[model samples]
Every structure is written in structure tokens, then in C-alpha cells.
Target: MTIKHKITLYSSLFFSGFYALIALFIVMSFASFRAEEFKERLNEKALTTIRLLLDVKELDNDLLKIIDQNSIHQLYDEKTLIFDENFNLIYSSLDDTKIHWTTGDLEILKTEGAYFKSEGENEIYGIKHLNNGKQFYAIVSANDNYGKSKLRYLTTIVIITFLVFLLATWLFTFTLIKKQLKPLDEFHENISQINDLHIERQLATKENSKNEIDLLSIEFNQMMSRITEVYNLQKDFTAHVSHELRTPLLKLSAQVENQLLQQKGENDLFLKSMMQDIAQLNELINSLLLLTKNNQTNPREYESIRIDEVLYAAFEKISHDFKDISIDFSIAESVAETPEILEVKASPNLLEIAFSNLIKNAYLYSDNKKVQVKIYKDNHKLKLSIINAGSKIADKAEDILFKPFKRGENTADSKGLGIGLTIVKRILTNFDFSIEYTFGSYTHQFLIIF
Candidate 1:
């Protein structure tokens, strides 16, 4: 069932059961109390009748005569039964055949001052020993008309009250549930209004809501924010990758096309230039793939790495591959006093690829024949800078240089796939590291912070 309906049903059931128990208790207690009150009034009347008629000290028929003559004896609904000491009926209102009067019934006057009770139908009878216990046994019966009516009335009222209470409880509980869930419903509505265009707007998590639903809404919005950030990064990365890869591919394809379509036999120098362009294209493709692979890995697998060692190893690999560039490095040692040597924890292969691309860019872009690689420690952060006497990027180009396939004014002299720095920045970001480019009158510098 839906949460709203489940809440309503549970609320209804809880109130119904509670009201039912309360109704049963009230009806039973009220009925019992009213019955006791009626019985007390009946007893009082019976005692009064016994007191007025009976002369307890005398064994005579004088009181019986007075009782028979009293005009005030109009309150009681009674039948007279007179019995002897031997427990045999002498004078009776009920015929012996009608009641089948046994010794037990005729022995109502057990002593000189005995009062006893018996039930017939819905009325109760109080038999009082009277007339000196010789010839008269006073029988007074009272019907509990008020008591019965009170019970019936109370029973009806109890049922009606229970029904009303049940309805009220259900409505109140369901209304309360709806009130509690209102914020959650609003939270969902706010989230639904959000899409790629509206990613910047966050949900309102009110402080007054000291509850789980509020926390859930806040966390959900945070997740959405992160997703939007990654999505934007991916879009920028894609655009940069396309722009970077296209130039090299076109150059390589043109070279192949020229070789294929030529009528004359291709010279060795022309074929060599074509092969060099093909190699540059292949290198650009490899770097882009490495960037994509790093982003695709399960993030949980990344770990802390020593920046100096990882960079030194990457530099060695690049130096082996490109023998033309004279690469030099100075690395600091890691220590308890110098934990800054370990900049971040990340996938080893990915960091290597990123650093490798940065060093290779300095080599490819440098007009002078040498590249300088330097490493240093600053607190817990590592700073690795690669400097080359190469093309000084334009002031305008600095803005879009990190964007994929973005080339600068100095681009004409070199074969570049424009996305190397973009990939490097992306890979470093995955490891929580950052990159900054410093361009000067004669220096093109890239700094990686660990």
C-alpha cells in the first residue's frame, strides 16, 4: 500500500480499538453504579414498611390489624403471605398450586426480626418478619424500572459515544499523519522541479523539522548536487576531448590519403613524416583513453600515494619513450616531518598517465631542447612543477587552455591534440588534487599540487 493510505488505515484501527475499550468500561461501570443506587432505594422502602407495621416486643395481631387499616400503605407493590412457626402457609396472595410453595418459601420469617430477599421476573421482593412474628410476614416488592431504563439508555449512549469517538479519532489521527508527511511531500515536489537547468537550486530543509524525513530530503538534495557537478565535468571533458583528437586525426588521415592517392612512388622522407603524424595521433588517443579509464574506475579503490616516487617513475618512462627531450628532476624525501611528499591517494596507473602527459607536453611544446621537472613539499601538500622553454601560451588562451581541443596562438609550430592538460586536470581532480598553469615572458609552466 501507499504510505499515505497505510498511515490512514493504521490510524483508524488504533483509535477504533481504543474507543471500543473505553466504551465497554464506561457502560459497565455506569450500569453497575445505577443498579446499586436503585437497590439502596428499594431497601430503604422495605425497611420503612417493616418498621411502621411490626411491633417487635409483642406477640399479637393488633399491629396486623393496624397495617391492614393504614390508608398510607400505597407505595409498595406487594403480596401478603402469613405463615405459622411450623413453616406451613396460613394465608397467601399466591395460590399454593400457582407457586408450589414448599417449606423453603413459607419459612420467610426465620426469626422475630428477619428480612430476606427473593427475585421474581425483574422485580425484587423483601420479606420482613412482622406482627410479632406470629401471624404476618410482610412482603414488599419493588420493580427497577428506572434502573432498567438507565441501563438501556446508558448502553445506547455508550454505543453512540463509541461510534462518535471512533470517527473523531480516525479523522484526527489521519489528519495528523497527513500533517507530518506534508513536508516530505513538499520535498519530493521541490526535487521533481529540478533538472539539468535548475541544478543550482537546493531544497529547503527547515530547521523546525527535527525528524528523519527532513534529513532524508537534505541528503537527497546533496546527492543531486554532486550528480550535476560530475555531469558538467563530463560534458566539458567530452567537448575538450573531441576538439583535441580531431586535429591529429585529420593530419594523420591527410598524410595517409596523400600516400594512397599519389601517382608517383612515395619518397622515404614523405613516408617518414606521415609515420610521425600517425605516431602523434596514436599518442593523443592513448592519453584520452587513460583519462576516460580513470574516471570510470570504482572510486572506492583509490589510495594514498607518494607523489615524488610516482612522478619520478612517470618521468623515467617518458624519458625512455622520447629520447630527444632532456628531462631533469629534483625530488624531496618523505618523512614524519615531511608527510607533504604524499599528496593524495589515487589509482597508481591513472596518476602516472596524468603526470606522464604533463611531462610529454613540455617536451612537445618546448623550443629549447630541455625540460626541467622539480618537486617540493609544503605542509601536507606536494608541489610538482614541469617547466620548459617552449611556446608561451597567450593571455586569452589561458582561459580555454584547460578546455578540450583548445589551441593557442603558439599552436602553429607544434603537433598537439589540445586535450592533454584537460585530461591531466581531470585525473588530478579525481584524486582531490588541483592544477594551475603559469605562463610568463619566456616560460610555459604547469604545476600539480598533491
Candidate 2:
């Protein structure tokens, strides 16, 4: 899951737990208050019943019973009974649901003035009443059915409200989090678009914001500025040094060759070796100059060209330079008659340079001085490959093979500057192409997919 989803899930859980506790507390508090309120109402009914029983002298048993049953206010399922000090019944408000009382219960009511007891769902309240020093007890009991029904309804409302609120909170939190992290999403997109070709471009920041994302953008821009400064300086130095050194190196090689031609003595071998060294140095200088151009060249210089024609030109050049090497070249029969398959948009000079490097590497490292070149179309993509019979590249070279100054085990027996493949890869990347290296049991292959 993404960070936004994780944050939303955790925040929903946290808020749900918090709201659940609040709902529970509300329910418990309301239940307690309702129970206490019912108890108070029962006690008040008992007091009122006793007051009428004691103060009304003309009130007979039937009249008192009638008044208790019909006129006395009571809660749902209410019942009442009155008893004298002698434990004889005076009046009963209920016909079937009786409030059973023992002498000890009456004693408690007489001593304490009021007594309360609960039997199952029924709540009973008893009070002692006195008239002319005569003692009587009045008792009331009920289940508070109306209050219980109200509480059930309230409980359902609380539960539904809690669920609705939880859902609303989760949606609101998810939306708010997505809005808040929008900057990070944009930052990631911008970072993905950055490459060495656009190294000088800076990350954008809000003008008046000092948030962490804004600060991060500021730091990234500063870092890119430093990298661009260093990269430009390196490119300039390489180009200038190569241009300056190539002339002297070529002059030195020419003078040494002339000396060897004229003398032809014991020092002839030494002069030839010195001339070879100068030639290798000159090659390195030229490769460095190409590298600088690859780094600084603009993509607008590219135009439509036949990739097959460029490959043939590079192959011919390598063939003329190294006649001892033999190369087998072929075009796939499927595309033999298809001229459009050979066309691609790229810089022909850069393409030829890259192909030349690959051809040279194949020639220098092949054990039998033989290479195979193939061009084909696979799955609507143009595929080109150069295979050479050579020692397999070392496993460690897979990661750093395209890096500058990185060579493989096969290059140990070859004369090279270790930047041939690196330059080839850099040149291809500018044209939206890439190179792949594959090792077979007896052949090394460089595959280019366009």
C-alpha cells in the first residue's frame, strides 16, 4: 500500500477508537441517570401515597384502595401496598403483582425512614409514615418500561450516529491527507524527469512557503547547481586538454617514424615502440574528445537516416583498418525487402561513431579475429547485434561495463582506453536507444534495441 493509504487506515482506526469510547461513556452515563431518575420517581410515589393514607381520616379501606388504584400517579407496570406497624395489610394497588415484604424489611424501613430493594427487573421503594405516633409503611415497585423503551431508541441512535461519523471522518481524513501530500507527489515526478542532460535545471519551490517540501526543493536546487558547475568544468577541461595534446602527440609520432625511416639501425625497434605508444596516446585523446562532445551535444542535430547504411559504413571503415579480421554481416530475410525498417531518427555521425567503437571492440577482443553482425525487426522494434568469438566477460563487469574507465576481463589482452563501450552507450542514450550485453558459452554479444 502507498503512504497515503497507510496513513488513512491508521488515522481512521485511531479516530474510531476515540469515538467508540465517547459513545460508550455517553451510553453508560445515560443509563445511570435513567436508573436514578426512576428510583426517585418511585420514592416520590411512596411518599404521596403515605401522606393521603395518614392525613385523610374519613378515608375508608375501599375508598383508600380505590384512590390508590385509580388516582395515584405511577410509572409503567407500577404497584403499591400499605402496611401498619402490626404487619397487617392496609391497601393494595395491584391485583396480581404483589410487593412481598418481611418484618425485617419493615423494620429497616421504620428505622431508616426509607428502604429500597431490587428483585429481578423490578425496583421497590419502601418508606415509613407516622400519624399520632402510629407507624405505617408504604411501598412502591415498577420496571420503568417507558424509560427503558426510550433508552433502547437512544442507544440505536447513538450507534448509528457513531457509524456515520466514523465513515465521514475516514473520508475527510483521506481527502485531507491526499491534498496535503500533493507537493510530495509533484516532487517525485520532477525528480524522475531529471537526468545528466538536464542537470542544470532546478527544482521549483513555492515563493512564500517555508514548509519542509519547499525546503527540500531549495536544497535539491542548490545540490544540482553544484553538480552542474562541476560537470561543466570537467567537460571543458577534457575538451581543451584533448585538443591541445592531440597536435603534439601526432607530431611526435610523425618525427619518430621519419627518424626510423632514415636511420634503420639498432635503435629502430625502440623508435617503432615509441611511435606505437604515441599512436595509442593519440587514440586516447581522440576518444576523450568524442566523450566531451557526447556530453555537450544537442539533440536537435539529429535527422532521419538509414541505420543499416550507417552500420555498413562503420563496418567498412573497421574492415579497411584491420584486414586480418573477418566479419560476417546479414540482414534478416523478413526485412530484406522492407526499406522502411532500416530508417530511424538519429545523428548519423554519432551513430557511426558508436558502431565503430563496437566494431573495434569486437575485433580487438575476438580470439579468432572473427565477428558476426545481424540486423532484424522483432515485435515491431528494430534489433541490431554484434557478436564476437571471445572469452566471456567477467560476472563483475555486468554492472560497471558501461561506466567510464571500466573494462572487462576480455579487455586484459587488448589495447584500449576502457571507455569504448561507455562512449557507445552515452551516444546511443541521446537518441533514445540502449545497448545490452550478453555472454554465451563461446561468444560475447552486444545487443542494441531501438
Q: Which candidate number maximizes lDDT?
A: 2
149: Cα error in model 2, Å: 6.7
Model 1 lDDT tens row, 326-386: 8877766653356654546688777888888888888887887688888776775668888
Tens digits of lDDT, candidate 2, 20-103: 999999989988898889878987887777777778888866787677677646466678888988878787774468676788
Over all chains combined, what TM-score does candidate 1 have? 0.43
lDDT of each: 0.68, 0.84
Residue pairs with backbone atoms closer than 3 Å in model 1 (clashes): 240-404, 244-405, 303-345, 304-345
Which segments of model 1 are wrong by more than 4 Å? 1-16, 41-86, 90-142, 192-201, 205-223, 247-450
lDDT of 1 at 154: 83
After superposing candidate 2 on the true structure, give the runs of residues whose Cα lies further than 4 Å from its correct spot: 1-21, 31-184, 191-194, 204-227, 259-272, 294-301, 319-343, 359-395, 435-449
